[model samples]
Target: MEVYSKKQQIISAINALRHKNQTLGLVPTMGALHRGHLQLVKKALENNNMVVVSIFVNPTQFDNKEDLEKYPRTLEKDVALLKTVNKTNILVYAPTVDDMYDGLTVSQKFDFDGLEFEMEGKFRNGHFDGVGTIVKRFFEIIKPNNAYFGEKDFQQLAIIKKLVEKHNIPVNIVGCKIHREVNGLAMSSRNTRLKPEHKAEAPFIYKTLKTAKQHFGIKSANKVTEWVEKRFAKNDLLQLEYFIIADAKTLKPIKRKSNKKTYRAFIAVYADDIRLIDNIALN
Candidate 1:
């Protein structure tokens, strides 16, 4: 696996690949990669002629300084894992923050108004703007033919789709399936922060979401929210951040008579300061 830290060098490498009639695919990620991230790389490799995985722990995306500081960094192990998957043609762009944002000040922010104030957005203020900024930077740098994101971050995936279309960026945004563990907990880099006990209980988020969907149905968004909230509240170790039944596309809180075509039950909880997020569809 070849690692490129400089923008010019990475661009030159990509251009050379293009010159050879290779189609480029990008999987942007923070350094602490897991099965979820690898799934994206696998999909990229399958569909595109060349795949580039970026492992930059973006500081801009974190709303809390402590969260940013504590975000995991296991680049050595991550690269080794990548090598096991494939080595010869894989490219890793692991660049510094300075390289990513040389002259770019995060002046303009993406509001995404309704979508910005629900589950993850309401709990972690300004989080998506930071996400938007970093992703915009990534798109500008890589300029891949296709960019892959996991469906676990449902709202983030929606916002990025809007960002790409609104800005008229030429890349196709591909959303991959949510990869889960044996116990059904959605795979996430933040899962590493959980203690063993917390990890065991972590699957409760998915289970709660599933229960809400099965019992209440989309016609009872409020009831679904209340049920999920109570489940989190019952767990003394869990501090409920937000439990929302929202329109998947807009991220707006669903109303009783609202269209139920695509609804998602989203939840965020703090298990002693380790915030975990999960969502389930209500369709």
Candidate 2:
């Protein structure tokens, strides 16, 4: 893997690959790599001639200062994992905040309208705008033929697709399946902060989501969310953040459904100070 921190170097390297007729793929990340991230890289490898993964934890995305401070950074280990997978044709772009933002102030913000005001967006506040800005910048810099994102951040994925369409970006956006641990907990960098006991109970989030999916035909969104909330509330250690059943695309609360429609149940919880999120789809 070739590592480049400067913009010109990265662009030059990408140009070289383009000269060779290599189809470029990009996996934009916030650094703390996990199985979920690697899954995206694997998908990119299969579909594109070269893959570039950007690992900048954009400060603009974090609403809470402490949350940003606590967010994990395991660069050495992350590089080791990438190397083990023989992602040799990969470029790891780790840039500073100044390098990313520079003199270009965040004057204009991209909003996914209702999509940004629902579920995670409602809780985080302005999170998607930060996400949209960074992703837009990455797309401009990388200029990949294709870009990959995991479905774990389903709402983010949806908003990014909208951004690409609204702005007329030329890259093909691909969504990969959410990668999870053997016990069903969605793999996340935040999971590292959980206490041992909390980690064991964490799988229940996914379990509940799966259960909700099974009962989507019988239960209303309100009932499903209430039940899940009650279950999480039972554990004093777990502070429920948000539990929602909404349209997978718009991320808006779903009403009565019809055939062939897809709904997703998303949950965010605080196991002590560590916040974790997971979602499951009902088709």
Tens-place lDDT digits, model 1, residues 137-231: 88898889999999988889988898888888999999999999999899989999998888888888888888888865443777767777777
Instruction: Write the residue-wise lDDT of candidate 2 on 1-283 in tens digits.
Output: 7888878889999999888999999999987898889889989989998899898888878889899998998887888888876667788888777778896635257756677788887788679888999999889988999999988898888888989989999999999999999999999999888899999888888888888887776988778778888888787777888888887767778887867667888888888888888888788
Instruction: Tell me which residue pairs clash in candidate 1.
Output: none
TM-score for each candidate, following the candidate numbering? 0.95, 0.96
Question: lDDT values of the candidates?
Answer: 0.84, 0.85
> RMSD, model 1, all Cα superposed?
1.7
Ten contiguous residues with the weakest lDDT in model 1: 105-114
- Which number leads on lDDT? 2
